[model samples]
Target: MLKLIRLEWRKHRFAGNFLGAGIAMIGILLFLIMIGFLDQGTEDFAFLDYQGSFILIDTFARAVFIIFAGVLISKLIISEYRDKTMNVMFTYPIKRHKIIAAKLILVFIFTFAMIMVTDIIMGALLLAVNQYYGFITEPLESKVLWQMVVKYTISSISAAAMSLIPLFFGMRKHSVTATMVASVLLVSIVCSGFSGSNGPTMSINSIIIIPLTLGAVGLWIAALSMVRLETKDLN
Candidate 1:
């Protein structure tokens, strides 16, 4: 599986994709850093503390990576069929399902890794900048920091699975555009209310069940997508 994943990375534009992801993360971090200055007059707002800022970043990062996963799928799987490039791969001694599974697994791992990495990097940067700027409204507690780690780990896992949901859509007609659209729509629906409302204000990471459920569905679809792979015609 690792060998297959490595080959996929080599075969695709993963280097450029990683570069794009890094640029996206930097943009997200900068925009978040500006929020403190932009909301100076408001009595209360988001990104004012470790907890709020962490949730906000997780939402943004997950949404971004889901799209990344979609693009990876297009390049790794959808484009293979659209361009008839996978026929070459189908000639290999390996089982067809293994090839497909490797691609999906790669997408899953990439999404999870991106979400966790972005949160940790952005969180640390915020904490460091807050030390000098004092823009974050509250002090971060050791307990709260640990909580963020646990939550992020679980969320990343769920999001990684959820990232595969677009495979079903893209495979329907081998449409890369549909895959892209599905990913953005998935993010909009899943992350739109990430920090749910409680009374008049918001609560951080309040709803995890939605992603968990959707992620399970994604896994199911991913498995189902391979059911016919064994006898699929490359001709």
Candidate 2:
């Protein structure tokens, strides 16, 4: 498994996706902060409030990283099939399921780490901005910062796991479009429905459980697809 992951990393080491994601992360954070400043009069805007700002940032970060994960899965997995490199992979001695697992594991780790790091950076930047501008109602407190860290941690993990949903579509026909489309829809639903003024529709615990459950289902489908791959003609 480690070997497979190493090989996957080598394949993507030169790819511009990571660099692009990094740029996008910074861009998105700045954009959200700008909106907060521009919309200061709009109390309904979640970014205007400190706690609301964190919630907005967390929701947006999750959505962006989830889409980024979908793109990674599409490029890493679907593109292999599209380009006929999957047949080359099939020739390897490693079990097909192990290969799939390794790829998924890489996606999960990358997505989770990116979201967590970006969220932390964005949160800190917003706090600093608030300190200078006095936009936030409450002063920055250690207890509040700790709560943000915990919430961000949970949301990041859940977002990373949920990203595998696109894998199910990717495996079906090796369609990158399908994977991206699924990601867009999922992100829209998650961000628009449960985030912001509406707040989470369910308990915080359910938010974590629901995405994790869906991710597990997606992995189960990927395992089943691997079984099919064993018998299906690679040609």
Candidate 3:
């Protein structure tokens, strides 16, 4: 499994998708900071509240990651079919499902790690800005900081898992655009549904379970597709 993952990384090392994601993260963070400054005069703006800021930042990060995961799925999986390289991939001694699993695992890990890092960085930046400008209603407390970390950790994992939905789209039609478009639409729905709500008010378990289950189902679909790949004509 490790060998297959390593091979996959080697194939995509220069693809520039990771670089693009990093740039997008930075851009989003800067935009959030700018919005905070702009909202300083509006007492009712959600960004004025520390807790609200955390939720808002997390929402934006998750939205970005959904799109990021879609692009990676397109590059890593859909591109193989479009480029007629699946036949080459099939020549390897490894089982077809294992190869697909490695790719999916890589996507999940990358998405999760990047989201966490970006979220933490954004939180720190926001804290610093608030401290200097006194925009936030309440001062940053250790308890609040800890809560932000915990909430973001769970949210990042969920976002990573949810991002896999695009894999199903990509595998079905082998169209990169369709995969990415589907991701954008899904993120739009999710963000709209939770726009004003706090992070998973129902329960922590609900927060973790829903996205995890969705991710698992998407992976199951992808794996079944791999089984078909074993005999399907590449032509």
Candidate 4:
């Protein structure tokens, strides 16, 4: 398992760095722009709006990050099949289950780490700017920060898990990129319907209920499909 993880890490090292750097760069840029505006001396920084700001930022940035994560995980998993490299992989004495597990573990780790790093950079910038400008009069609660971190992490994983549908398609047809885009589009449709009045109608609880249920279902489906793939014919 360790060897499989090491092998997967080597395969994805460059891509992982690119994804992490992209997240950091965008996060820092956003933080800078927000601080720059706040520093213009006309506006006061009030933490009263922090909750709304957190939600808005989480909605936009996390959505983008999740899409990136979906693409990264799909590409990582499908690359082996798309290139017909699995045959060479199978030549080694490694177990197929281990390979799948390694991929899953690595994707989770990479996505989680990237997100945390983004948060840390943003938080540090906020702290520094608040210190000098006294824009935010109230102290920022650590608990709120932790909650945002947790929520973003879970959201990213859920998005990555949903990418399994495309991973399945990629495994079967070897068209990783096409399958990934299709999967993301499908998820977007579902999400849009959930929020639309004329679309999939449900109770108020449906908002919270539906997404949590779907996330759980995606995780389960991914695991089952992975297990099935380990034993099924790859040719």
Candidate 5:
């Protein structure tokens, strides 16, 4: 399994994806830092508070990385099928199911890791900026930071799994458009936790429910697809 995963990693270095993610992360960071300065205490900026800021940042991270996963599904999986490279892959010694599973594993790990790391970096910047500007004015404590980390970690896991849901759509004819669109819609649904309001829908208890549920569904679909790939002709 490790060898297969390493082979998939070698096949797609994801350099473009990493560059794109870095650019988006920088944009999110700039927005987060500037958000404090733009604060006017209006309802428009209500989600600019500590927790709300975290939610907003997490939302951006989730949405970005999920789409990143979608692009990866297209690049690593669907596009290969469309271009008939999958035929070449099947001719190799590797089992069909193993090949797809390896690709899925890479996607999951990459999405989860990127989301967690990005949130941590952005959350730290939020803390540092708050310490300097006193914009949020909420007393920072070790517990609060720990809580943020816990929440971000959970959300990252959920998002990474949920991201694979698009595979079900993409595999129906290997339509890249369906895969990408499904990802966008999935984000719209799961990320509806906050808007410009003071009452953020993203609470600790509510955080894990939707994403985890859909993530399970995605995993089931992926497993089923792998089973089908064992017999389905790639020719």
Candidate 6:
């Protein structure tokens, strides 16, 4: 498993690094601009409030994941069919389940790392702006901060998880772009319909769980579908 991960990492190092650096830079720029608008001599609104921050974080975090998921899904799954590399991949001396698992694990790690990097950059920016402004409103308690971070992280992962549905279909027809677009549309529809006041704003944990489950189901189905493909002759 470690070897497989290392191999995938080597292949994707450029993409992963680029994603991290790009997001961090964006975060820093946003923070600097926000700080510029702050009252330099006052201590008012210097802290971050969970409620207000939640709105911004939730929206931005989801948007970021959606874009990344689309690109990554297109690249990772589509590339296999586009280049006719699955023949080589399936020829290897590995179990069919392991191949799917490795790919899934790579996606999981890649998404997790990206989100963590994003959070770190965004958090630093928020902190810098707060320090310059007077603190933002009232900085979140450590517990609240961590909770929000974890919640947003899970949400981001779940959002990416939706990509598996499209990948499953894409693998069958060998069209990654089509599945990628379908995945985005499906996720957008679900999120738009299931999110907001029209739906339950239950605890953050509940919100995370709902999509997490959906993603898990999609992955399971993808895996099973891949098993069938692995055995079928491409010719």
Backbone clash tally (model 2): 0
lDDT tens digits, residues 24-74, model 3?
A: 888897788677667656644657567767767777788888788888889
Off by over 4 Å in 3: 193-210, 231-235
**Model 5 misplacement above 4 A:** 33-39, 44-48, 194-207, 232-235
Query: Which ranges in model 6 have alpha carbons more than 4 Å from their true place?
Result: 12-48, 186-206, 231-235
Which lDDT values do the candidates have, in the order given?
0.81, 0.75, 0.75, 0.57, 0.81, 0.59
Off by over 4 Å in 4: 14-20, 31-48, 131-139, 142-165, 186-211, 230-233
Regions more than 4 Å wrong, model 2: 194-206, 232-235
Model 4 gets an lDDT of 0.57
Q: What is the lDDT for 53 in model 5?
A: 73
Model 6, 105-124: lDDT tens per residue? 66666655665666566666
Cα displacement (Å) at residue 66, model 6:
3.6
Q: In model 2, state the lDDT of residue 49.
A: 58
**How badly does each model clash, as a count of residue pairs?**
0, 0, 0, 0, 0, 11
Best by lDDT: 5
TM-score result, candidate 6: 0.71
lDDT per residue, candidate 5, 111-149, as tens digits? 999899898888777777667767676676789888878
Question: TM-score of every model?
Answer: 0.90, 0.87, 0.86, 0.68, 0.90, 0.71
Error of 2 at 134 (Å): 1.2
Local error of candidate 4 at 96, Å?
1.2
Q: What tens-digit string does per-residue lDDT give for candidate 2 at 1-235?
A: 8988988889877256679778978788778867766766764655555666676777777888889988888878889888999888878888877887888889889889988888888888887777787766667678978986887787777778778888777767778999999999888766664444533233232356666676667567656766777675354
